[model samples]
Target: MAQIQASIEIDAPIDKVWSIVSDLDSEPKFWKGTKEVRNISKEGNTITREVTIAFKDSKCMQTVTLYPKEKIQIQFTKGVIEGTKALTLAQTGSKTRLDVIWDMKLTGMMGMFTGMIKKHIQSGSEQALESIKQEAQR
Candidate 1:
């Protein structure tokens, strides 16, 4: 398993950050790599989403586990993708510290070509964090 982790401090309450991060439908806006997300199914803490990433050649199906105001974890349920996870909204002092961890395994050629793309995605994640911070602080 490979993990790409990024963290940033937001000058807002945990609840504030949770509102934006928990809404999976609007993820594409702040998350640079996410081009679009459609909610396929939802029940309790589980939601199935179809997402098209910026560099990805095709859409991917993701099964996301939500923990209300605490965290949200997403993993690929189908398609060429292997694995992915995002941990959101960790509290630190009066502000909120959000951390996202992604673990992925590509098949065939995509696996070999993942290095540069992985770095780009990680950089985008970091930028997304800063965007969230600015929004929350406003």
Candidate 2:
């Protein structure tokens, strides 16, 4: 298993940040690499989403759960990389600190490219945070 992480401080209150993050339909506006997000199904608190990445040739199916203002967890149910990811939020004074962690497992020969995958995830996380911050601050 490989893990990648990134953190950013958003110039917004935790409530505003949580509101933006919890809105599933607004995901693509702030999520990096995601070109489109389609809600496949929803059952209570769990939702299945189909996500298409901008440069990727294929899409991924993920199960997502929102824990209000605390965290958002995602598990890759079907995709090239299989694993779980999370976004955690903490409020400090007037700012909200957002942390993103990606825990992924590669298959076959892809396991040899762990370093590249980690870099990719870290970069994506940073981009996603910046986008989210902008949206939340607005």
- The true-versus-predicted C-alpha distance at residue 23 of model 1, in Å, is 1.2
- Once fitted onto the true fold, the runs of candidate 2 whose alpha carbons sit more than 4 angstroms away are none
In terms of TM-score, the best-performing candidate is 1
Q: Write one digit per residue (lDDT tens) for candidate 1, span 16-124.
A: 9998888788888898788888898999999998888776556889999999878888989876667977877777889898999889876566787677667887888
lDDT of 2 by residue, 1-138 (tens): 888888999999999999888887887777666778899899888899998865444588899998889999999888666788899999999999999888887555667876776777678778888888888888
Q: List where candidate 1 sits over 4 angstroms from the true fold.
A: none
Q: TM-score, each model? A: 0.92, 0.87
- The lDDT for every candidate, in the order shown, is 0.83, 0.84
Angstrom error of the Cα, residue 109, model 1: value is 2.6
